[model samples]
Target: MGKKLWYHSSCLLLFCILCTNSFAQVKPADFKYVDHILGYWRMPTKHSTFTELWVKKDDHTWEGKTHRITGRDSVEMDNMQLVRSGNELVFTIAAVADPKSGKPVPFKVTVLQSNGFVAENPACDYPQKIVYKWKKEDELDVHFKGVKEKTFSEIILEYKRK
Candidate 1:
């Protein structure tokens, strides 16, 4: 009787442990993935350098600043916004701000996020696309399509943790 009771107690303890281990824990929405993308990313190619500022806003929206820097010339800004649509991520550029004018002009572009981060530019007659690939080392690989071959350089844009 003593041996049977001990065995029954061990089985009960094992059952409890198995049940706890099988239960899946829920992850919070504002977790690691979203946090990683929220910062300044510097993209450097053989030809030029560019920096993008990703600012998180209310309602899962992001304000972005795309700036191109060349030689001694000042930064040229492209103002844009990003919002998640369904399972895909969507980006809309409000305008391409000219340094000379210092004004925001009408401009728009949309990109569908794929397995890798892809931007689809369908507004123009020719389709322009941008793909952002992540490396194992935590660097972002950027590729531009429908543009000049040599002109489109490979850049590793890395995010700085805040």
Candidate 2:
């Protein structure tokens, strides 16, 4: 009787684990909407040119990096990832010199559309909200908003496909 009980408990545990893992995995169809963002995007400023390169790592994950180029020097500013976590998509960013030991900060994607999406992380110190909009086939607009110096601030970046 004890042996049977132990076996049932083990089986239940295994079933629970399997269910959790299955639910956590992202489906490939859910990731297809973000496919259009894969490519090289460039935004030139007066002092430097900012570039973002995005590539798909797998059906469930996309990786990206931002770089600032001034003269002959190119410096990586941040690393980004778009991944499916369960039924939802998460956008993560890790600055090269982040104050929190460069840990990746996660922003939950709240709005997803054919042309763009919005991700928000209210707990983040800066850029609590991130917005991406496609202006045209070759143009993209990105906006970051948060509080800085005790005042609300927002920065907009316009990029062209390169």
For model 2, the stretches where C-alpha displacement exceeds 4 angstroms are 1-30, 96-102
| TM-score for each predicted model, relative to the true structure | 0.47, 0.76
Highest-scoring model, lDDT = 2
Candidate 2 lDDT tens digits, 41-145: 999999999999999999779899999999999999988899987678988887512475767788878777678778888888888888888989889998999
Write one digit per residue (lDDT tens) for candidate 1, span 63-146.
778788788774757766656544434555545334566543322223222213455653422225555555533455555455
What clash pairs does model 1 have? none
What are the runs in model 1 whose C-alpha is more than 4 Å off?
1-35, 45-48, 69-73, 85-88, 94-115, 121-123, 147-162
Residue 128, model 1: lDDT of 51
State residue 62's C-alpha deviation in candidate 1, in Å: 1.7
